[model samples]
Target: MHLKKLTVVALSACFGLSACQKEEAPPAAPPASEAPAPARAESAPQQPVESMPPATATAPGSGSNLIREPVAAQEQPLQAIQTKMGPKESVIHLTSAKVTGQILTVEFVAVPKKRGDGRYEWLNLTLPLKNVSYIDDATAKKVSLLQDDGEAYMASPLNGTGKSIRLDGHSPITATLKFPAPPETSPTISVNFSDIGSFDGVPVSR
Candidate 1:
């Protein structure tokens, strides 16, 4: 009886140790796709973008800038003629005629004339001005004023305005008219001032 009890105790101890070993065994290996991924490296910082500057604007030349003066103000010594004008008449006297290179300059003063309405009008002339050139003694051909590329006559501006000059009735305004010079063979030329009539034997100096 004692031998059988000892055999039973040894078998029970062997079974308990086997059950503990089975419970403590490691878990089954997971599938390759289910495994945790490796960690990623940190990225470098981004740079900032710069903006461009705006363009600058430019201006064009004004009317005053384009006007060229033919003669200086001081060089022209104006004289006051006491003689008056009659009604229904416009008077212009050729004071001086000067030939310089290819140009012939004629300086004249317009006498304050009485209008047909009996009102006295002073000299008021416009720019890019035009005048009558009826004769040239040298060529015997009618000479015209020199024209620029813009078709404007090369003449002094009426005033600093590049426009017209307006003078008071009491004061005489001396103005200049330029024409293409006649041939050097003639020291004088006849200029017909349209309705004002022709000024013959007008002397030309250098």
Candidate 2:
């Protein structure tokens, strides 16, 4: 009986020690889904870059962006005068003579012969005519002006009425003539007619 009791005590002590050991052991690890995640790093903001304008190439043998200068012009010289008046001739009377710049103006009166019954006659259609004659045979080109230095100026057809006169004479007719300018220093001149004589020592006016 004593031996059976000792065996029962020893078994009770072993059971108690096994229960304490099981209680002292650590717990099992957690699942991957339940674990905490690692922290993320913070980043700085980026700046925007500025775009520049395109450059232009200059033309060959050309200047810069500044404006260019203007060029100058050329000019001509003026003409001079020498004399004004000329002598008078028969059948032709000089009424006036004047000078203005490079132009010369002369006025005169001419008396022509009466017309004959025939269609053409020497006295009727000939001699010299004026601006108001009925005959178309005479022209102002018949007259000319000469300087004291022997320089002669011819009448210009562009200055006057540019019409030729005919001699169907009833009365004296008046006419005007134009000539090129003479030298500025000429003090005396003469007027000459193709058929009539020349007049001299005529005065010059402004």
Candidate 3:
């Protein structure tokens, strides 16, 4: 019994049983093609696999694809939250998606730092969109592009090499989401938010 919104009600029942197909709202993170790219974070970030105390995520089991919902989503229980983010507790708690139940991912690395001294440095990022378009920027921050029936879907202009971008905060940086065609059997339901790594800020050069 857990389903905050079940990926927008299972993507509006897979685009069909729609009475009007109006329920868009999930786009905020678009603008980064060139201008602001200086947090190179050499290397650091590793001691974080010693787990044995962190639980509180139930609901995600109706059969498969996992996205169940009946009622379950109040959040804030997994060890109280915040797994890493010093100097002010930026926000951490990276990734967790129980192939059959939980789906926890918290991250907001604005400028977090702490490498070489540790081993796990990161500015990670992970979301949805198997077919993308929109890549090039200075970051003023104001993303918007939803479509499950609702509307609003524009951005999609940065690719062709600027797409294979890299963050190297320790590893991780993949992009590509801006579909319109060539997609009919891959996006039945998707929703993600990842970047877990960094609780101590530093490295700023905008």
Clashes of each: 0, 11, 24
User: Per the 3 Å backbone cut-off, how many clashing residue pairs does candidate 1 have?
Assistant: 0
- lDDT of candidates 1 onward, in order: 0.59, 0.43, 0.30
Local error of candidate 1 at 184, Å? 1.8
lDDT score at residue 194, model 2, on the 0-100 scale: 45
- Flag the better candidate by lDDT, 2 or 3: 2
Q: How accurate is candidate 3 locally (lDDT)?
A: 0.30
The root-mean-square deviation over C-alpha atoms between each candidate and the true structure, in angstroms, is 17.9, 27.2, 42.8
Task: Identify the candidate with maximal lDDT.
Answer: 1
Higher-TM-score candidate among 1 and 3?
Answer: 1
Give the 10-residue window scoring lowest on summed lDDT in candidate 3. 97-106
Quickly count the clashes in candidate 2.
11
By summed lDDT, which 10 consecutive residues of candidate 2 come out lowest? Answer: 131-140
Query: Could you tell me the lDDT of residue 137 within candidate 3?
Result: 26
